[model samples]
Target: MKFKIRKSKILRNLFIAIGLLSLGNLISVYLIFNTAGVEAKVTRLLVKLLNVNLEANLPTYFSSLVLLADAILLALIAYGNRAIGGRFWHWIGLSLIFVFISLDEMIQIHEQLRAPMEALFNTSGLLYFAWFIPYMAIVVILGIAYFKFMMSLPKKILKLFILAGVVFVSGAVGMEMLGGLHAEVHGEDTLTYALMYSFEEFMEMSGGAIFFYALIVYIEMNFEKLRLRFKPKKKKKKIKKIKKNLIEA
Candidate 1:
């Protein structure tokens, strides 16, 4: 059997999803802040489901699924490159990183570090959410280690990868740092903080979608068509019974 996928279609759909999610988040924020009277039960439910700032919601699930998709794509590319043996480890390493990131996105493992890191470093202001410190260090080390691998990739892929990384980091770390500063001073229950987090989530989702599109393009360029087939096992003939009957005769 054969299956065909359009890279552009996937990209378009991804952007559409991101746009809808962003709109939903904005609506939830407006309903929460702008509405003066008591909110309806349905409105509260909508806020719970659509709020980008809240965890275990639609936005969180989408982000986690996007990262998981990236991990799967990276693993597929790594498997394809394994035959040629060039930068196989690099591809696999990236796959593992995405896998961890996907899990962290869902479970928020990094959030656990915030308290310990703050206590250890006496962090405040932009560093109020101190979990990013360790993550930033890891990113720097990985970047240094993967410098050669990045340079070796095709120009188109290199550019896409860098763009994805920039967008993701800007949201996951940069805007997060700014949000932390705002949160520390004025607290988390403010319109500005909500908007900051909403933008941050949007950027993160956009980055993942971009990277997923890049992987689809890469697969199309390098692997051509991905296919799957199924075949039934053959059965052996029963000759022993016939031979025994002939000998008895």
Candidate 2:
């Protein structure tokens, strides 16, 4: 039997996962606010799992997984670009960026830089996190460089890709700014901080889900069919005596 998966089917499953994860993050935030006696431990665990509370936890792991998936899909698309006599290196560069992001997510590399950034900037406003400076610059550069390529994409995919970038950056950068300001003023232990983090994580995951869907659709549209099949079971047969007798006859 063959296993057939349409692009829309894959996208639906990704969207469902994104929705569930978003709900989980929201619940985690609620628990943080309602932490009572016995519920305090549960709340702590949920916070650790759902936000940037700690390293090597659920949210970080899930983010890494999504980024890694994005990197793989981008790499595959790069190969497709090569096959079609397009700018394969450009796609490869984007894929490498995603890979770096995946690694950063798993290792919490950016979090480590926060202290040095704070010291260097000598400010606690938007630039408290110095990484955003370079990050935003890179984003702008990539946007300008790929503007035409993005325009060349099919309208549906182009729209989805742009939407995904906007959502992801809004969370990664926009919410980050808000959280940093709050933490600078009220410390990082407030309900507001937690809520902001929850929204940031949700947006990141949702953006990844959208990007994954777009990439799947792109591959399905451009490449040959994708399917899976299991090998049929073989049956043992008796000796071929009947066949030999018929030949002799």
Candidate 3:
């Protein structure tokens, strides 16, 4: 049976998936703070990694910047690929899984912090975590779907995910390069310094995760298609050759 995907449905699904994933992430955070707790060493490391000075609103500003960039990225992606909008639901579902996994990672990495450890979120943090829900959710569901159904999808779409990963990596490098220039001239605490730049780091991690696994998903989804189109055709041709030889003999 041919699978038909509606564009409107795609948009709706994307929104929903994003919502679910975001919810899961927040829930994880809530649970970690409430139950798991973080390590003291990890807490120090996060503060240092985040580079939050007492004077500057760096954490808040940095978070805002990261999320803003992420949102812009999602918009750009949705614009370029209609599938992002149509398969929006799948993406959203995947996002929930993604967030939970990442959240779990965070919890695992920091099991010694105070219950209300300073997460240091801002407007951008909200945005980053918010849209992040869908990205993570879609990936999670697809991962399971591969093992469960394993329907072969198209190569073009698969390539798109790889391309998307490459593009995102490129953007991260660009951000780092740009930030580096400013840091060298401005100083360590300057906005250009990598330590003070959550925007670039967040993109590197979040975008990287999406595209890296996206490539995996794309390949798994299209594995059957590639086999059918290439391998199956060769099998048919060999059968035809054998039949002709038998007839001639």
Q: Which candidate's lDDT is highest?
A: 1
For each candidate, what is the lDDT? 0.89, 0.77, 0.41
Q: Per-candidate TM vs. native?
A: 0.88, 0.80, 0.30
Backbone clashes, each candidate:
0, 0, 33
lDDT of 2: 0.77
Residue 187 alpha-carbon offset, candidate 1, angstroms = 1.1
Question: In candidate 2, which residue pairs get closer than 3 Å at backbone N, Cα or C atoms, i.e. clash?
Answer: none
What does each candidate score in C-alpha RMSD?
4.5, 6.8, 17.2
Write candidate 1's Cα lDDT for 122-231 as tens digits. Answer: 99999999999999999999999999999998899999999999999999999999999999999998999999999999999999999998887777777654443233
C-alpha positional error of residue 128 in candidate 2 after TM-score superposition, expressed in Å = 3.0
Off by more than 4 A, model 3: 1-46, 49-155, 192-196, 223-249
- lDDT score at residue 187, model 1, on the 0-100 scale: 95
Writing each residue's lDDT as its tens digit, candidate 2 over 172-236 gives 99999988888888888798888788788778877887898888777777666433223333321
